[model samples]
Target: MSIAIVDARGWQNTLDLKTGEKIDAAGPVIKLVKDVLQRHPYPGDTDPGSNRWVSDTAFDLIDRYAPRFVFLTYAAQYFSGRYTPMSKETRARMISDVFLEAERFINRSGFAAIAVGTGDMTPLLGFIDVTRLDGLAVCTHWSTRYAGLYGPSPDDMKILEEHPHIEKIVSQEEVVRLFDGTPEQTLRLPEYLMLAREGYAFKTISDAMRIPVMIPSLNFNVPLHAPGHTVEAITGIRQILEEDLSEKNVALIAIEGVGLDEFLWPHRPCRNSTEWYYYEPGEAQYLTIVSGRHRFLDYPTGSGYKYFNGAEGAARSYPFSGHFKSIPEGAFASTFPGKSIAVGNKSMFMHMVTGADLSVECFARNLYNQGTMAVIHRADKL
Candidate 1:
């Protein structure tokens, strides 16, 4: 079979077949996807309907094919409350409720191995067989006194170094050196990277409170944030797919905005470590996981990157030029020799990131009500 892409972002596009006719003619997998989309027909990313789309689509896919590798993104609840003004306690509980529901599904669903995010990768080994990889020690930072927005002044940088919440400050040059990344990766990177202490998160100098990254204790022999135990999104996930999923079904799900304290099922299998880079604007993180590289390697973030990057842009339904590179490769989807599929409510991500054999995501324009669309790769067509 070949790679198939399902885009369920907008209302039924101008197609020859009526919506009902299309669903009837489609294969069972595609039919089931449309059914789920219709059931939870809401149109916004933060809406309950969107979250239901994520959970329902995942459950249906698992029951039908039990695909060996499954990746899901459940962030609606996190998105709903992280930025809203509310009491810290009230806000924490709001997010926790959402995590609990998702965790409940994981506990009940019997997968051979599972890995949850917002922590280091090795901790997942406690639940399954896996290897650790290098994760940057990323912290959210904001100026305590200065009103700096973009780049901090040299004098302000000095004060930032001594800020109570600051752990260590870094520059784009330092980031490249630290990660062994190419200079291109540092483009548009914050002028001064102010890392937060283990228990802290920072907002922009002018913004209000920021959420700190939290990971479960997992009761590891060493502390959760212990040095050398941390894992980043890109390599950590690659290791899981390579080493953990050995001829058995595996699920790698990420519940955004839920930190350590908010993770409902800490007692369940998983590990704890810091998310090294910016976790919000999650499209970047998803790309990092699917590509096994930092997003910066491809210039122009998000779907825009698809236009210039040969590996990502190839096979997309939209028009693109493969100028920067030839014979495109790098995305795991491009190389994986298996019948894999990805389904999630995150728009434009399944194809952009995993490029799985069959990838499905919310339709960006209409999101809800409109049925999903599918993309079948010429090489791996079913």
Candidate 2:
């Protein structure tokens, strides 16, 4: 299949110092998105503005193309204050604003079968029929990193359980069982998993902050199948995708950092993970939805794609393997017979996670104004 990939990373970034800081060129997708939203702000200004730009762009894409399946990942909440120096309260306010603005656009976007990252948005989106819980957060015992790998110390484990933020402590063995058992070396899953209580996320021994965080949860009614968990929801999303897409559209909006506490969409109580099961890198989490299988490829440090199968070059992407041999089978988009599009601001994620026909992601280079690019299949790298 010939899929069109559009990268919208630096759409608002237009400064070229060599050219006297002139505004950069805007791509067709950016132009279209800007036209619909009726506002354009440099994404670097604030966390809410960055996320809203991405979310609004996704809404506009769906409205314009009316594709069969739409997958969106919003990243500002996760990226904003975590790395940069910002007060915790300021970060929290920015996230709230992003969600609030997203709620307004999603309701008016006109798609009926919408799935979001949290149960918090479910009630507000009266038109939504299905929901999935994501961004679930858990407290980790960093000091026990090496010790827990072998087997957590009984005394240390007991101490971890006493923490006020901890709801339950899941051990390495228990975590292995959760993903149906993976070789510990392959994924290097966390050793001592400290599941956090609602309204709290573990930061440091001195600081367990009460903030919105996420951990992976059971894939109940979601479109993709997760290997170990039972689909408790009445209608599975896989069935819905294949059956309904013949006559309608489905939107899967993944709010990256906002979990149940932050995104709270009022979903029926479903199972959350005992601890994070994927590799430490954030991209691994997407595999649960895209491939619906275990972590077959192991990434060393940065991106899975960068090191996988010796795919080299600065771009860090490979061809569309179509689950034929290169990657895991049953990738959602690889199976789709119709047009599917994935759009997100997270670098290299849209193409890596969903094998959508047309994948659009924020340009990794410049977040300010450079603009989006399309990913096309070459004999070698993307």
- State each model's C-alpha RMSD to the native: 10.8, 11.3
Superposition error at 319 for model 1 (Å): 8.0
TM-score of every candidate: 0.57, 0.53
lDDT of 1 by residue, 285-315 (tens): 5556656666533532231111212255334
lDDT tens readout by residue for model 2, 1-382: 1223332443333232122233434455435434543333225412456766666666665666555777776666655533345565875776677657556656776543444452221111111100111212222221111112223456545555575545565555665566556474435444444544433334432213222223222222223222233343322434455555666666666665454455445443332222342232244345544554444233212211111222434432233221121233455776776656676766666665676655555554323544453332111111
> On a 0 to 1 TM-score scale, where does candidate 2 land against the true structure?
0.53
lDDT of each: 0.44, 0.44
lDDT of 1: 0.44
What candidate 2 gets wrong by more than 4 Å, as runs, is 1-47, 84-92, 116-240, 243-247, 269-281, 296-329, 365-371, 376-382
Model 1 CA lDDT for position 135? 15
